[model samples]
Target: MPQWSEYTDGERIKILRGMETRQSDLAEMTGLSLQTIQQAEQGKRLTLRTLIRIADALGVDTSVVLGQQAPRRSMQRDDRAMVRDLSRTVHDTAAGLLDITDPPALEELREASKACWDTYWRGSYMEAGALARPLLEQAAARLHDQPADEQAEAWGLLADAYRLAAYVANLIGSRDLAYAAIGHAQHAAEQAADDVRRALVMSGRSWVYLRDTRLADALTLAERAATDIEPKFSTATMEQLVAYGSHVNFAAVVASRMEDKERAADYLSQSHATGARMGQEYRAHGTVFGPVSATTQAVGINVALGETGKALSLIGDIKPVHERVLSGAARNRYAMDKALAQADAKLWDASLETLEGALLAAPQWARHQVLPSVIVSRVATGSTTRLRRVVELIGTASSTGGFPPATPRNAL
Candidate 1:
């Protein structure tokens, strides 16, 4: 057996295809052209979707083709169980969680929502989502029982619970689950009649679009949602300010991904203005948006736009206030973006340091993110020791016992 990284993609595909399966058969099964199959086996360029299709046709995980660790059998079973549990929670009725005549107090609902948000921000996604399911059931059931004046708040709480589920699923790379969760949020927001909460749900929808590579739709929705939530800074509450700023920042991210640097900059500028109005870091409606967050997100937007110099310049401007303000996940993501800028500039050592530091700060979050893996792959050829360390931290480094998957140097 050879180290997974040592073999070319074509060789791995050939081995995976084996003697029993022919290229024509694989092409037919995967709905890919015979030529495409041949090209892939010859180590030609293939899109991620195409690779995934091929991997699935072979009855294997994408990791099998990418030369990464195949998930353990136990992990696979757990994932299946989670999916089942989520489905049941989403479809099942809340029959006995609360009395129809005497619902839980509004304050209790608010506290439960707040606690769930805290759990998510603290990076306890699994726990938070588990908590959210029951909260949602109770909230949904209680929405009809609330007085006319309090019904909106009840709906808002339900929306938040659904958003929690969607956010957690998105973070974990479960797009289908995320879509289901977002749908529930959208319906709940409609009932709530809350512009800010509706905008928040739109933000989640944009993430699902991004995951599917629908950049145009993602940008359009995010921009429209941001516009819809734009408040008069002079009178807007802190919560409104946070949601507005966060939505605008998210629009900037979508713009950058769509390669519209000017649009991205415009959105980012608007976010900065909103943050200026807020004055300090504020987490509201499950979003972190303030001066620090705008600056931090700006770094990533600049990197995505290929403005390495500007990205680096922004990094230098990050103040001590930022360290105390941003969430651990946000800080780590910013560090990863800085590392990307360094790598693009060929400052390999600085890139490695930034990358390593981020992994150390939030190992679990970093491991689940695709960015760290992408960055490490870029720098891996130069420093074997650093590569190994990153691989260890991520827990998916190539093993000698498994076959290598096709990994183009510029895949990310």
Candidate 2:
């Protein structure tokens, strides 16, 4: 038998989906849309949750599907495999532990849940996804056994876990998983009757919409979420500050994506105001928000608006001191935005340099993201050492096949 790792994900799926099981069968069993199954079979990206669903439906260990790591054609391709394998392990393990009648110790559960956030912020999506499943399952089980007095607290924790799962799923390109997870989070938050958590769930939903390119829905949801949590910066707790600021920033990003510069700028101004109140970057509810994050995100927004000079200026204003404090994912995203700015300025070498740094910082995440592919497509065709290294890291010119064209200099 050929090693599963030797084949691309689509090929592996085809192999597993023998004559006995049709694509429709897998889709039905996994609770995934036929489109998702088809995409996976066509070698398009599938999220961790989707991969887990498929593996479980097929009744095989995830390792059977993933096999040992092999050379992938591109970073995007590699990420699809990594997330799929991790998702399988998480779901399979969680399924087996579902019969436990007793709740886990609260402190242990808290620590485990915290670890998931830390892992994700550090840009280890597979590790975070693995941790999230147990945290979500165990906390959800607590809802059945915990005392009535502790029910609200249990629900709150479960909501957080669900929200974390949603975030993890989103990171792994599990669109449907993200949707379901956020829905659960919202329900749990409602059960907990926590206003703050409810608002956070709304923001999470907005994030899902953003990922799906539902820009109008994302903007509307984000605005509503921000309004729900608009605390007075002076008297608000750090957590409140972060949540409100993050929601507003998300609204700004959505507006930018929609090419509504006026609305985007308005949202950015609000975000800046919130950031000024916070005075520094603050993280809460698995989101990081403040002056630095706002400024960094704004660079991308400006780039989206085709204001490359403004984006470059924003890049210049950011100090190394602030850069060092960004999480690995944030740092890489900022680098890609900077590279986009450079590419627009026709500084191809500088753009490549920025992308090289980003690839090294978070290679796994980089491989799955479109930004790296976009940068590579726009770079000069000549083969320099840096270009060759980027090709090695991200795959060939063909890896970006069928991707939308580069944003024109005057697209906005």
Candidate 3:
């Protein structure tokens, strides 16, 4: 696992600042000397109760910081993976120690968490989410500390891990785990300050709601994230900051699913405008977004706006070869978008061809392709018998809220 030394300077600085602010505020609230506060902020000395006191003053949930190693396209061989893993473990341990109350347990958690982080970073998002969750829980239960600050931080880290776990589990069709993971994120959000970190917990919740097809709740949470609660954050600032674009795009997708085309278009326009002002390149950064969210937002809004043509054109412009590596997921997603775009244009043959190719490439996630497939089938076959088969295929594969219930209004 990675050690504390493995962390970037920026990460160290962020942790330091959080600790310092927490300390000084505690001192002022308790009428302690500024020198004492300054000394603690500088890591000169701190007592168990002092840490606990500051934790209370700062409203820190626990010592665990919600951090992730940088995303990589691919991990190295076993030897290299082992080295990176060590670094991650060490780094998480140091970060955990900043707020841990029990010295020995904190050390153990640090070591364990570092390994967890490394393992998580070592695989694809699908694999990482699955592997990291149980370990996160194991570490959480094993670590015991006294200081309130340490207690809060440790709990917070556990919550962060669960949130990640839940998101990935939900994506992969694990409902029970997703629910539990959401519980963890919610738990973390409660003790978090009005920071990007806190907002992310909310963001995680939004994803859960989306996966469940609970559009109203998801929209509510997403809109909350888009708000300016974090005063220093700009609308365009990506860093850990929440962007209105994500909310807009998410809302757009929900609207599109509901077949509320006008509403979807409105949301799409708003998202597009937000994305524009946010800058495509900047939005792609971990600051505003990463691959999934960034591309998802762009693709979703455009598709909803009935401008899939334009959206596919933009996707093509991106050249899809990220760092000379053609990510299978990205490629599949691109094809899916193209198929949908063709479907929108009423080019059934082209849509069918593209979708068939996508299904062959990655069959599991082709659930989203079901609707277009149904439409294409309907267009190609006038017989209601074949159309029903096609719809059944779609219903079985779709993650949508049970075939949209087949309302009379939509039937028309």
Score each candidate by Cα lDDT.
0.75, 0.75, 0.49
Candidate 2's displacement at residue 14, Å, is: 8.4
Give Cα distance to truth, residue 268, candidate 3, Å: 4.3
TM-score of 1: 0.75
What local lDDT does model 1 show for residue 139? Answer: 79
Q: Give Cα distance to truth, residue 264, candidate 2, Å.
A: 0.4
lDDT of model 1 at position 233? 81
Give the TM-score ranking, best first: 2, 1, 3
lDDT of 1 at 323: 63
Q: Write the per-residue lDDT of candidate 3 for residues 1-412, one digit (tens) a residue.
A: 3443454433422343342245455468646666666655555655565555443443322241122322111111222233233234333532453343334465565555555444433224444553453445444554344455556655555555655565555544445556766675566556544255466666667767766777678767766765633333243355532345555566676666556677777766666565545453332111233333445555645765667676777656655343123234445655666666766767666666666666655544544233345445435523355445445445544423211221111210
Instruction: Write down the worst ten-residue block by lDDT for model 2.
Output: 403-412
lDDT for each residue of candidate 1 in 58-77, tens digit (9 for 90 to 100): 65567756767432211222
**How do the predictions measure up, each by TM-score?**
0.75, 0.76, 0.52
